[model samples]
Target chain A: MIEEREIHKEYEIKENPLVDVAAYLFLEDIADKQGAAGMNNYLISLATSLAKSMPEEEYKTWEDFVESLEKGESIISTFESVRAKTNHCMVTHKCPFERGWKEYTKRIGDFARVHKEVADYYNSTVKPGVNDTQCIICQTFRAAAAERITVAKKRLKYAQLAAVAPDGSKKIAPDEWKPILLEKAGVTNTDLNMVLRNNACIWILY
Target chain B: MLDVALVSLIQDMSEKAGVEGTIQYWERVGESLAMRMGKEAYMGWPSFNVALREGRTAYSIEGDVTPLTDLAVTDVDGDVVGYIYALKTCVFEPTMQRVRYSVGDVPQADAAVAEEYNNSVKDTAICNFCVIHQKFREEVAKNITVADQPLECVQLADRGFKGETKIARDSLKRIGINPEYVRSLLRNYACVFAILMKGARLKGEEEVEE
Candidate 1:
C-alpha cells in the first residue's frame, strides 16, 4: 500500500505557495468588484472562452481531454483517478487557489475585503469573530475553478456528438451544456454545492 | 530567531487569529528584539564603510552578535531591484529545525495546525532565523533608492540553502568582493541567509551599447 506520507510528499513537491498567493489575490480583486454571483458568472465565462479557444482535436476523447487539461498552465497539480467504474469517472487534484486563500487567512487572519454578499454568506455559515479555514471566499474560487472541468467535459461530449453525426446537422448549444454535464455526472445542485464548499478537489464526470 | 516561548505564543496566536495576525504580531516581536540587540545591531552605510576601511569588501561582523550581510539583487536588465541580508552563523537553527520537524508530527486531524506551523516556520526561516528579524529588511528597503527611483513592494523571498551559493556569489561579484574571504565563508557557513525584496522597474531605460 502507498503510505500516506508518500502521497503528502507528492503534494508537497507540487505545492507552489507563491502561485497560491497570486491566485488568492486575484480572487479577492474580482470578488471586490463583483458580487459572489457575478464572480461565479465571470469564472464560467472565462472557462468557456478558454475552452472555445482550445484546439478541438485535442479533446476528442475523455482521456485526451484529461491529458490536455493537465498540461494547461492554470492547473496547479496532476490529477489522480479516485474512481473509474463503468460510466463513472472521478478525479481529484489540489487547487492552489484554495490553498492560497487558506494560507492567506491563516497568516493575515482576516478575509480580503470582498463584496458584502460574499462576506455575508461566509458570516452566516461561520461563527462571528472567528477566522478558521471554513472559508466561503475560497469555496467561491474553488467552484469557479471547477467550471474549467465542466467546460472541458462539455467540449468532449460535443466532440463525441460530432463524431457520431459527421453531417453536423445536430448540435448542442453552449448554454445547454451545464445541465447536460451535471446530469451525466449524476450530480444534483445540492451535491455540487456540498462538493464546492467542502471537497473542492474531487470532480465527478461521465 | 525567536525563543521557544515566543514561538509557542506565535503558534498559538496563529491557531486563533491566522497567519496574517501572526505576521503582524511578529513585527512587534522584531521591534522588541531589535531594541534588545542594542544600537550596534542597527546596520547603516557606516557599517559598510567600516568594512571597506578594514580592507573587507563584504560586510563582516564577529562575536555572538547577529551578522547582517547586505546583498543587492538585480533584475534581468541588471538594475538593482532590492536588497537582501545574509545572517551568518544562525543561532536559532535548532529551534527552526524543531519547529519544522514538529509540522510532520502534527496529527492528520489537525491539518490546519500543521499548515500554520509550516508557514510560521517558513516566515522565520526566510529571515535566516536571525535575531535581527524580517522587519529590518523592510526598514532598510524603505530607505534605499536605485537610480533615483525609490524601491516599492519590498517582499521576502524563500530562505533555503538551495540557491544561496549562486545568489551570494552573484551579489559578491557585483561589488568586486574578496574571493578568498567569500570562499571561506561559504565553505564554513553554507549560505544560510534569507533573501528579501522583489524586482523594481526603473522609470527610464538607458540604451546600452552592445
Candidate 2:
C-alpha cells in the first residue's frame, strides 16, 4: 500500500545529534540554493520540522555525541578541547533548537571544527555519478524550499503593490513601497538585504 | 564615439576585483543585455543623451551579430568593437533548441533534421539536436578565434542570428545534397563538414568559396 520512498524515511526523528547534523545540511542546501535562505526563522522551523520526522533509535544525541568522542568512535571525537566543554552546555543550558528536542544537550566548544566534519559526513550520502542515495530526498526538500521562497516573494510583492496598509489606516504611495517590501520580505541578514536592495535599483541615463 | 562612463565602471571593477577576467565578464553581461533589449528597445531608453544615441546604436548592432557565439565585443573607452563571423554556411533553426547545429552548411540541406524542418510545417524538429548543439559553445571556444578576441559568454537567443547563413542556404539550393547525410552528420557530430573545417570565420567578405 505504501510507496518505496515512504519505507526508509522515519516519520518522527529521535534526538540524535548525527541525524540532526544531516537534517541541518539538508535544510541549508534546500533553502540556500532555492533562494529561501533569507527567511532565517522559517529555515530554523523547517529544520526542526524535518528533524522531528526521524526515529530516535537510529540516531545519537549531544550527550551521545560527546560519549562517542571519548570512545574515539566518531571522526568528531578526536578533538580534546571541544570535547572538554560539551558536558556543561549539555547539563546547564540547551541550545535553542535542542531545548524542545531533548531534556539535556552538550554545547560544542569548537563548533567550526565540528561543523566541517559534520558537513563532510552529510555529503557522504552521495558518491557523485556512481550512486546518489539522497537524490529523492533532495528533490523533495528543494520542492519544499521552492514553495517557501515563492510564498515569501509573493507576500513581499503584495506588500509593495498594496495601495493601503493592511490595517486600512494609511494609504501607501507607489514610490514608498520599496522599504515596506524589504521589511515584509524579512531581510534580516546582509545577503538577503542585498537581494532586496538590488530589486529597487534603476539606472537613469542622460 | 565611446562610452566613457561604462569604460570607467569596467576598468574600476576589474582593478578592484583584482583581475581583467571580471571586467571581461561585465562587458559580456552588458553585451548580452543589449542583445536582449535589441536596437529598437535600447534606443527607447528615455534618459540616454541624444548625443550618445549613435554610439549606442553601433553597440546594439554589434551585439546583434558579432560573436554570435557569445559576447562578441570588447568594451572600449565608450565604444565596443564586435566581429560578425563571415561564415558562408546556411544556419537554419527549425527549432529554437536545435538551431546550433548547422545541417545545410555544405551548400545544401543535407541533415535529416534540416530536410524535415524545411519540409514539415511543425516548429519543433522530429530529431532534437539539442544534446550535440549544447556542446557547440565549448567546441567553438576550443576551435574558433578572430584576431585574438575570445567569446566570454556564448549563448543563442530566441531571435535567430542570421550570419553567413544566406550563402549556405543558397548553396543548399544550388547543390543537391541528401538530407539523410546531413541528418547523419548532425546526429553524429555537432557541425557539418564545412562548418567544422572553416566555421565562423570573420574576415573581409569575399565571393563564396564553395
Candidate 3:
C-alpha cells in the first residue's frame, strides 16, 4: 500500500523535477529543432509557473527563484563554449544535431583523452586490423560531417530547381505541369518561356 | 549549450534519480521539433534560433550554428537585437490526503491515526522537495540564450560584444554593477561557464586538421 501510495503520489498533480527537467528539455528541443512554438510555449509556461511556486525558504522571493531560471541560459552558453572547442558551432554555424545522442553529449576532449588507452589495448593485444584504433579527430570530423549532411538535407528543401533538356533545346516539355507545382517546383517561373518564337517571322520594315 | 556547473548538477541529480533515460526522451522531442519546424527555425542541439540568412532556407546553420541559448544576433548596440519567443509549462495539481479511522466499526486508536498522519506529512515533505527541483528545471529552460549563457544585467549590457572579459567588465561598470563583482562574475560565469557553451563552434576547425 505504501508503494502504491508513493507511485500514485508521484503520478498525482505534483511537480516532479525529473519530469520538469525532461519536459523543459523536451520543449527546448522542440523550440530549437522543430520550431514547435506551441509545445515550447507549453513547456515554458509550466516551467515558469513551477518556478513561481518555489517556497520562499529556498529563495528570498519568487524573483530570486525566477532568476535561477535565467541562469539556465548561462548554462547553455557554457555548453556552447565547450562545443566551440570542438568547432561544433562555428564550422557548422549551428548546433550539432546530425549526431546520435551519444555523440552530442560525449565531451570530445574527454573522449580523446580516454580513447587512446582503449585503442592501445586493442592494438597491443588484438589481431592487426581487428584492433582498429579510433582517432578523436576522425570522430569529431565524422560528427561534423554528419551534422553537415543533416543540414544539407534540410537546406535542400529550399534549393533552387532547374530544368534540363534531353536534346539540348529550349522547349517546355509536354512536361508542362500544373501551375501550382510549376510555381513551387523550379527556378523562378519568370525564367520559363511560353513559346519559342523567332525573329525569322515576316516583319513589316518599320 | 549549458553551463558546466549546471549541467554537472543536472547530470548528478539525474543520475541520482536514475533518470538518464529522460535525456534521450528530450532529445527525441528535440529531433521531432527539428523535423517539424523544418526551415522555419534552426534546430541546433540544446537550443534553437530564429534568424535566417538571406538566400538560405534551412533550419540547419550552413556555418557554425549558434546554440539557441546564445544571443549572438539578438543583441546589438548594447540592446536586445531581436524578438525572443518563449515557451513554458503549467503546474500540475497537488496530491490529495485522506483523513479518518473507521474500519469494521472497530475504533482505531488515535496513536495509529497519528502515525498515518505523520507518514502523510513525511510524504508531503518529500513531494514538496522534489517539486522544487522540477520547478528549477523548467525555469532554467526558459529564457536560455541561443547559447547557454545566463541572462544577467551585465551580460545584457554586453550582448553583442566581441572582446575579452576586460572589455566586458568595463562595460558592465559603465552600466552600474560593481566593477569587482562584474569582474568576478565575468571570470567565473563568462570565462569558465559561458566559454564552454557559447564559444564559437567553427573557429578552430581548420587548426584541428593539422
Please name the candidate that would achieve the greatest lDDT relative to the true structure: 1
Query: Which ten contiguous residues of candidate 1 chain A have the minimum total lDDT?
Result: A159-168
**lDDT of model 1 at residue A103?**
46
TM-score of each: 0.33, 0.18, 0.17
- Overall lDDT per candidate, in order of appearance: 0.35, 0.25, 0.25
Roughly what TM-score does model 2 have, to 2 decimal places?
Answer: 0.18
Residues B118-162, model 3: lDDT tens digits: 253222111111222222322333323433343221121111012
Q: Which candidate number maximizes TM-score?
A: 1
List, residue by residue over B76-120, the lDDT tens digit for candidate 2: 232233312221111223221111111112211123333343344
Off by over 4 Å in 1: A1-12, A30-96, A113-154, A157-183, A186-206, B1-210
CAPRI grade of model 1:
incorrect
Q: Sort all candidates by TM-score, best to worst.
A: 1, 2, 3
Model 2: docking quality category:
incorrect
Off by over 4 Å in 3: A1-206, B1-17, B40-203
Candidate 3: residue B202 Cα off by (Å): 6.7
